[model samples]
Target: MSAALRIGMDIGGSKTAAVALDDAGTVVAATELGTVRGDDGVVDTAESAIVALATQTGVAPSGFASVGIGIPGQVDRGLGVVRNAYNIGVARLPLAQRLSARTGLAVSLDNDVTAAAIGAAHLMRLSGTVAYLNLGTGLSAGFVVDGVPLRGAHGVAGEIGHLAVDPRERPCPCGQRGCLETVASGSALRTYWPAGGDHPGRVLLSAIAAGDAEARAAYDALVAGAASCVRLLVLALDPHTVVIGGGLRLLGAPLVDGIRGELDLAAATSPFLTELELSARVQVLPADSSAAAVGAALAGNL
Candidate 1:
């Protein structure tokens, strides 16, 4: 008899991706679709994506053992509900239950970043305490302890992006001022850049490379805020590794190098900081991998 297949879907703000994995964890097929707004739309999109993947893999829906989903915003896995996903316009949705009803398979849901952390940990073969810092549309993090992403008491343990890091009191959609995300996220950087630029991050990086003073200052602040986030994670959890991922990670070496420079400067003045070895512990996720979807599939097995 053939091994049962597992389906994993990553419900992102702009796009939804799904992957079908055989029992051994090898991806058999994948599909992508643009996300639709509203609770019913999102659920329909997820169901469609899974059907597409199953078709691509030449397997019937009943061939899958389970379906796992990674969604942005607050999710109650136990209840299979998405409490609030502002980016995707879904609020208090019974995502898993709805998807399960549509696909006739068990469904599991988790925060997208947490699913990425689980995938990153598996990809890197990391054990013990690990941190996954995602600098995507908004900044957030996921903590994994002993190979399981720590969801915390309220399932918000790694929502560090909202922590206030700047004294300037910049407004945040989360109704906070000077949250780390307000200064360091991709969305925040676009707001900081000159209006009408086709690519704000690239523009800022190019100007910084050209030694523009204003661009340098702005970029410096972003790096400083990110380094502070790393410091906070290190101090709080002392994780064995801090893996950086998400949209901003596309900046590649320049982004990692900039963060390292900031931590190095701080370590020079504080022996405790030096002891943490923040620079050495930091790593970036590999390019061209759909980590969240993979992790969601793994979550199903778990």
Candidate 2:
């Protein structure tokens, strides 16, 4: 029999990325396209992207055993629907069913961060408990235990972005005050440095390098929120490793160092925190890795 081909797609607010992997999970093809809003537009865009990828790679979509998708929103995997994905402007959309009908392939759908964790774990060959903290346009986490993602009862187990780390009443889109995303995510940094241009993260980094006080403060807030996230995860799941991914990972050493410093400071205050060794357990994935797409594809196998 031909090796099973698994297709994975990561649907983001601005762009959509898709990849095809062989039975062994090696990427055989990949492509990207601009994301579209609305149910029909989104489905059409994904279908076109997948078809284009298959054509580019000289493989037919029907040849693939199944398709897996990672989307930025609350996904009801059991129902094969996206309950809400504000960034992509989707709500109550039957994403998996629509894609399956269009592509003639079985479909598996999951939250982007959750799929990313699966991909990261597969790529890193990580066993035991692992946490994937995504610091992207927004912030959230995905936990994988023994190769399976913990979806929780409501499938929101890792929605740590809205955990309300700050009490100063900073408004969040989720109708909350002081959500971690309000201070720590790419969106938060952009709000802090609104004039930072298109790539706010890079702009903020440059400003920090130039000793810009406001920029520094924003960065510090990000560090504190991120550190709190790790602390909470350590105390709750106590995962073997906390792998940091997403757009914010682009901040590179500065971001990692800041998080480490904050964790270290907290560790010094309490031996119990010190025992967690969060700094040592944290790992950063390369910014360019297609973890979400790869993981989405792997989701089909699961």
Candidate 3:
């Protein structure tokens, strides 16, 4: 039972990942599992992940120093409560308290995007300001300034997705029109290319290759929206790096290249944007990297 070991869990809409970090902050053991929906199901799923990591590391769950969780939704870190996480069917839950009571360890919670931002800075060994743009089920940005996450006064700092930038004014679930999210996210893809089905990013490239006009249009909009986010982050935060993360990042190099290309195109006219070097600062989160989970663990220590 190593008291130095710490646990971090990232509970996503469809998947859950857990990792155990050694005293030196290196990941020693990790596991992934399907996330179960609803309050009890989420708790059970988290407990199962803890058990799996504990077994792998030959340490009891209670032996860990603390449990940190990165979850989607409005997280009340002070209260250890999460609400409005509709993707996982968690309307409201005292996640940290529940998990702590179950595991007999301290627990902390962070917004999933903020956690990823912190993890990206740590893993990439980046210093100075870093802005993490999450292009996933929804669009959002997270910031880490000199290794400290900027969660803002009310925890709504990086919610640029709802800015309503589109002239057409598409409706958003947040009750807004023309939100950047409505044009950029996975949900946006589903709406734009309904024939592509639930997970559009997976099949989008192939569809583009097959000459599907609709798919091409949707992909183009996604690229444009993402580029807009990068530009917005730079103009606002002037971050040293802007790391693109989240599920759509699975689209890989093509997606990154498209974003850079868009930025370059925009910079072509605006010397202001050119000097900022927006495209050069962009980087993609590595595939299969447990950034959110790792960040969760780090957040616990902070």
Indicate which candidate wins on lDDT: 3
Lowest summed lDDT across 10 adjacent residues in model 1 is found at 193-202
Residues 153-253, candidate 1, lDDT per residue (tens digit)? 98888889899768988999889899999888777777776541645665777787787777676677778888888898999999999988987787788
Candidate 2: 10-residue stretch with minimal lDDT? 1-10
Alpha-carbon shift of residue 219 in model 3 (angstroms): 0.4
- Name the TM-score of candidate 2: 0.96
Ranking, TM-score, top scorer first: 3, 2, 1
| Residue 299 shift from truth in candidate 3, angstroms | 0.6
Please report how far candidate 3 places residue 216 from its true position, in Å: 0.3
lDDT of 2 at 168: 62
Each candidate: RMSD: 1.9, 1.5, 0.9
Q: 128-196, model 2: which lDDT tens digit per residue? A: 999999998899999899998887898798888898869766999999999988988988888887766
Each model's total of backbone clashes: 0, 0, 0
C-alpha lDDT of residue 186 in model 2 = 89
Q: Which RMSD does model 1 reach against the true structure?
A: 1.9
Error of 2 at 141 (Å): 0.6
Please, what are the lDDT tens digits per residue for candidate 3 over residues 29-139? Answer: 999999999999999999999999989999987788888899999999999999999999999999988988888889899999999998888888889999999999899
True-structure lDDT of candidate 3 = 0.92
